[model samples]
Target: MIFIDYLENVELISCGFDHNFSITNKGEIYSWGLNSCGQLGLGDERNRNTPCLVSFPNDDLIDIRIKDIVAGNYHSIFLFENGQLWGFGSNRDGELGLGDKNNRSNLTKIPIENVQKIACSKFHLFSLAHDGSSYYAWGSTKYGNWLSSRKLDGQPASFSAASAMILESPITFGLTSKIKVFQFQEPISTKSIIRLFNNPDNYDVKFVIGDRRILACKCYLKSVSDYYCLMFSGAWKEKVEVEIRDYSYETYYAYLRMLHYGCIGINQNRITQLIDLATCYIDKRLMKHCKTFIRDDLDEQTMPTYLPLVIKYEIKELYDKLSHITIEQVLPKVTDSILQNNENSIEFLDWFYNQRRPFIPK
Candidate 1:
């Protein structure tokens, strides 16, 4: 993922997934083992064995060739060609300028003016420009200070471009004549997070439920909504077809109204059509709720309500399994009360509790 350009003039002298090392076209060097304190000047703390190349192009902020890299606990800095300054990787204390003590993994060009030099300490940095101006600084540390131009004595370490000299990493421009360490870093979000267990698909699987006999028959129910308005009632029992006198329209609008507004308005004779649609899914959740509604009132006219329609359609194994539990539990005090007893209910509950779990065992 780390791509290098004009690298033909480069060589892979070293690597430090957690360290540093660098080499040049002529096999020059710029390195130390893991720079836990940016002491290696590789712009970051990390150790490396073999040497690595650290040169970047001179014009681009990033592609500029690097003289060396260094790391501080919370900052890193880079020295560039033409006396140009660039830094980042960490600036929790203004180790980098353009004024905020912000850390940047990517190389950032510092906005300090003139021919220059910079240096870094554990959490402080110093810079010196062509004018020989100096700066003092702190924070992301808790200390707050500044440099020359006494009139600007109490400015934000990065407030004035002229008074900004702090860098996260200390860049040795050419020895003792280095910049002062007053630059501080800006804030960044490093919130701790538990990134795992964020997705359900990572554990998606099937789940099964309920009696099989009635459930199986429920699947065979044909939806009248599937019918068209041909108005020819053919003998479904045989292969005979019937013709119509006039093209009659099926009141499909009733079905549409039911779909769009959740209101089933089909007339009495047409009730079956919409009822089939409403209960077509044969959902266990729906059936669970239906248990109460089925016991509300008993009237022969409410055939669609109290009929054993679904029960008769259930799977034999599940029906038989459920049947073992008498009517006292399935429908105590109701028409099927005598069919299931309380003891059977207790046994069924026990069986349910003993079934294998449907989810991955936690």
Candidate 2:
């Protein structure tokens, strides 16, 4: 049953049997229900029917703030915004990273640091660290393998932070109760937004693009773009007619679509356009997503196309990442023609060679 007094400012929620855990907008934690094994972090195994604030001792005096929460069969762990891990629960199989099977009723700080994300099961724990360059696991060793000592591969995409909430209307008594809904959104090429555009009651403004006019909501535009926020926040003229002449119609539209939704269709044909547009808008998040796309799609044939954009944007992080993938995958096939045709790749090669790191022969 959903509680009538639902939590406010909650960013993420995790649940265990007879209990619930949540991280709030201020990076504070709240837990409700069973505390049989001290999972509630209330300093005792007392059950709380209503949500109770859970906090570390002197939390305000410390630099750590909780950002994520996960739960096991009877245990719970919290991940801090600064990449620290702490836990309080039954540790029958060392699931708490405490290196022992000891039960703790209070939040105990773990030694692990630089942890970006954490996950746990009934008898195991998994942590993604260094933004996913490294992974660490601990807990019940089973299936005849020491999974705890093994390293997992792949880097995680840039972290985007946002707060979301679910709103519920008052409960009605009858099955034939009214269910009226109201939502206003913008028009875009994406199929999801296309249908919303067709609804005459949706848009609040229109953005004229080339030969076509795209309808949009002023609130949405302001939410995603500082430039648009300034323009629509009573700082500029209140005229309904407005024309954007900076970026091309296609790129700007795609950018807007990305802002409305969380994704965009990207390929070799339009990757550069998106990145350039993101750069112009100073949208580091969008730019990071585009770079991650280019990183994953990097190949010997595609490196030429990607390298120039890396250089144009001065993306040193991506430049080094591309160099690492290239050297690790296609070093033996490197040819003089490949180097001659791509100057940016040549620059990467020079940087790689100067690193003085040992490279094993293929």
Candidate 3:
């Protein structure tokens, strides 16, 4: 296999009809293969079997760091770190977005800014603004130059339009102002929500665990657990401080962190305690997350330890999965004494051996 070892740490690659382009982590652009229409952006219409460095036209090459590269049938587009776009190669249908039907042998900056993303077809190009709400389309209208806008809920609206002629420049298209546009509040991510955990800034509730106290948000806790929802809404609506007696500070802290950060902050050693806390609060989502971790950690070595816990919690899925473990897998590592000490393990062995006794000779 041909290895291009010189192009180390390549961050992105794009391929055209016959040409290819690559961008390195150091913001360097390289191109090779067919350059019949100057798609290689090498300042000349010469094909290159080996990769060559792509240079900008102006003397400010040092500041022209490329963020992304995309290639069409015979054209190429480059997005810069400053959110500006540049293009080269075939422009028969203005696919280069250069505002003219002329092929460019070198990189030429297009009249667009704050472009977060760029995509192209054989004869059309599309760009998304950094705002993430605005979209633009340009190039051959015969190949359908149009943009369809969806509602904030991701449902398609009954609004779509197509241009009749070639688009020499990028044009903004979406639902007209007359149409109702749903303006939904930006959803908070778990990563962002987790930042508020144990933060005293905007806490509406406090949990006193022995000598320690933890600040928390009522709205967040209410959303995750039915027990918290009822407790906070019914009797403790105005209560700012509540005492936790059943669980240790570590377990309760981990439980709150799990509510905010999912299972990412869960400690493997404290999973059993977390499961108990989840069960006490009747938090099925948290229980499911704990079960998933247990299932993924279940194997020959862990089977003996986790089997009883699985049965205690009535985790039928895990119990059924453990029932399928081969004797070969257990006998090699697990000893008879280890299996005999736990009644659950002994019972599992009895069931397993009885099921396969017909196949075993006397």
Find the candidate with the highest lDDT and give its number.
Answer: 3
Off by over 4 Å in 3: 59-61, 122-131, 143-362
lDDT of 2 by residue, 226-313 (tens): 8678789765447565676766677667666656544454555667877887787688777776776676556554677888998899
TM-score of each: 0.28, 0.42, 0.40
Residue-level lDDT tens digits of model 3 in 26-132: 77778998898898999899999988998877655467676556677788888776788888887766666666678899888777777655555433343222213
Q: Least lDDT summed over 10 consecutive residues: which range in candidate 1?
A: 212-221
Highest TM-score model number: 2
- Clash totals in order: 69, 0, 0
lDDT of model 2 at position 188: 27
Superior candidate under lDDT, 2 versus 3? 3
- Residue-level lDDT tens digits of model 1 in 204-297: 1111122110011111112212222111122322222223222112323333322222222222234333334345534333233233223322
Query: Model 2's lDDT to the true fold?
Result: 0.59
Off by over 4 Å in 2: 59-63, 122-131, 143-362
Could you tell me the lDDT of residue 50 within candidate 3? 88
The alpha-carbon root-mean-square deviation between model 3 and the true structure, to one decimal in Å, is 23.8
Better of 1 and 2 by TM-score: 2
List candidate 1 segments past 4 Å from native. 1-49, 55-74, 122-362
Q: Considering TM-score, where higher is better, how would the candidates rank from best to worst?
A: 2, 3, 1
Residue 24 local lDDT, model 1? 46
